[model samples]
Target: MPNNRSAAEISECIRCGTCCKKGGPSLHHEDTVLIEKGLILSKYLFTIREGEMSYDNVTGQLIPASSDIIKIKGRKGSLTCVFFNEPESACTIYDKRPLECRILECWDTREIERVYAKTRLTRKHLVSTIAGLWDLIDDHQARCSYEKINRLLKMLGGDNKDDALKEILEMIQYDTQIREMTVQKGGLDPDIVDFLFGRPIKETIGMYGFKLKKQGDAYRLITIPTGQNL
Candidate 1:
């Protein structure tokens, strides 16, 4: 859930460790710096293979970060992750974790995919070129369909688009699983109200959109239901 907390309000959370098992989904390049600075570990005690392109075991489809996502089936003992501290049921490194870790949650009300794309690739390529597919989506919720996100990223710029798509698909699944989605009551974002959704803020109060109004006497924002007339 993109961390609704303001920095001042954000505190280190207690270890719940539900996320330690997968290490994390695809991470940005800057994420490595955080880990290097003692923010988090490699997730794997060590990567058996770094960004090896292959397929998902369950889907039986080749994936780029095959090394991290699934173990080479039958090659080694059932390749469970090294960092999954099952005993503690918590992350070994929480204080210096990355944005991915900060956003991950065990569950959220939103229905999202279970797996997401991953790769040893740095984060730069993911955001600028891959996430740039904002032009293709039909919604203004700042979302890309799981299939669309992969297709667009593959068609756009990337060293390995096929691998990029595979990795990206993993990230998409992972992001949603972690509640890394932007949620709105009725597809409302003031900018998009002006742009995409095209629903007016005040004129059509009952329109198919969210209901919002000024908070206190200040510019703070809050949302209300369409029925409450807030």
Candidate 2:
């Protein structure tokens, strides 16, 4: 609701911390100093995969469109920014906060959007510090690319239909196992793992017009009626 106003009116802030309570700010290139100074740890941040649906802050809509956002970790089991001290209603690292935080004005969002459109911190930027982690992510993505899965699904219905379906299901199970082993060995955080690998194998399969049902340790595919949208 901020509009053209005097400097004093623009400076007015209630310090309610409502904005911080909603979610953590995305880090930008300008905020790298905070990480370099050790005020913010890489482990305390996570990435949102490209193509994933997320809020469009500039438009103020919950649209399924967003870039690979790197944001500070929120409190365990809540969306509140980790730096937010609930009782105190203040940011713990206010001075060294991310660029988005430093530029935000509750009364006006123009400054924030201008900064957001420039540069943002991404997984690639952190690759040098965590090369092995990035390698693992690349390996996993190569193995489970959606295009590969879609091709496998399309190969169905020619001959030996049942056998082909069984093979696809087994491949999915194998992919899941590989992800589990990688995460276990890498000791990467679970949130990071989920973001990198995306939804479970069964849910992903569903996106291709097939429903996966879990039976004990195995899986079964249930095809939807023909002509139904995938």
Candidate 3:
């Protein structure tokens, strides 16, 4: 919060408009339609890929479009969030922006400092939830998608999605197998569901490293693999 009257790291902003220019934000049905008509155009419109949506025949909801979290790019080996606009300077769709951008601000230098301080520990802790994101993060030499940034926001132990889910969503869609893992210490194996998706064997739930056997039981989850995680 050092800048007080200014944006967090605002001095660092070059007003490049990269966030709005190079990528697409998730479009609501109306936003999509407007764009198709060539009316929703902005000086910084992006090339977007839309996702699957369900129909509601009744109207109002129109259509729901999901975007790929945030678009990003590598600048001199540092990855920056694509929507990080520099001039006229703000989120193009601030009122309806997604949770991650919602969490960012033009203040909070302490936050920026904290993230850089324990990055290695945080990366090791969060690697499983994100899996392959490290390659992308490493490509930029910055860790932008870390979900643990919000770990302090956890209020209860059971079902919820705040900081953690926001962190996960920042990089990827929800994995279907989160429910199946048997977490002995509140941690699941590192992003193994894809190479070995579905419920893992019950006995293997808490242990990490190559799953030696195919889980015979349908309902039991198993531990598959894990890395030292940093």
Candidate 4:
């Protein structure tokens, strides 16, 4: 027998923990209540901003995100969801999981596919009403948008490469300074910075084959050699 088991025919969850280990689930509109109710915390989340390059597990490619993808943070140094209890092969938040987690079925994936990209929760959705902080986040997005970074990366290979590099360096410096300021001066939780501003440009720039070299208090952006640290 071919063991013709269709996804629809699979009715029970095996509690194998495959999905939780893969990575954290992205927040959806319905999941906002979890955050509002304090079941989930901002410190445990991060954002993939619009136009940022990220791996699409479904498409199996690195693609530019079309909109904000706010997701739970992974365990430090690993992609596994922070709330996953690996020893027990279970999710700590299983009963209060995000919409993506509730809908996900490793064998089928149809339910998750249909709702994954719809009604995603973003920074504005969560913090737009807050005084001062929203202004800072808005300013940060304008000054350090991935859209602008992509354009600058393209310019690096063009006639005005020097000017482009200078601008890129300035953006990187600003991004780093602001993050430090928020933690040191604004009394913000360091863990929540990723959720507020997306990942630091100095680190995320690596996706475009660039890395930073520090010389005293100043920083320089340089291209990585082929087949080297990506």
| CA lDDT of each prediction against the hidden true structure | 0.36, 0.69, 0.31, 0.88
Number of the predicted model whose TM-score against the real structure is largest: 4
Better of 2 and 3 by TM-score: 2
TM-score of each: 0.29, 0.67, 0.19, 0.93
Query: Where in model 1 is the C-alpha error above 4 Å?
Result: 1-18, 22-24, 38-52, 55-61, 64-81, 109-120, 123-230
lDDT of 3 by residue, 101-216 (tens): 33223234344233321211112222335555444323322322112322312422336645443443332222223323323332544333322222222212122221223256
Which model, 2 or 4, shows the larger lDDT? 4
In terms of lDDT, the poorest run of 10 residues in model 2 is: 1-10
> In candidate 2, which residue ranges exceed 4 Å CA deviation?
1-11, 64-66, 143-179, 187-213, 219-230
lDDT of 4: 0.88
Evaluated with lDDT, which candidate comes out highest? 4
> In model 4, what are the clashing residue pairs, if there are any?
none
Which candidate, 3 or 4, would have the higher lDDT against the true structure? 4
Q: Candidate 2 versus the native: TM-score?
A: 0.67
* RMSD (CA, Å), each prediction: 21.1, 6.1, 18.6, 3.4
Candidate 3's C-alpha runs over 4 A off are 1-78, 105-230
Candidate 3 global TM-score: 0.19
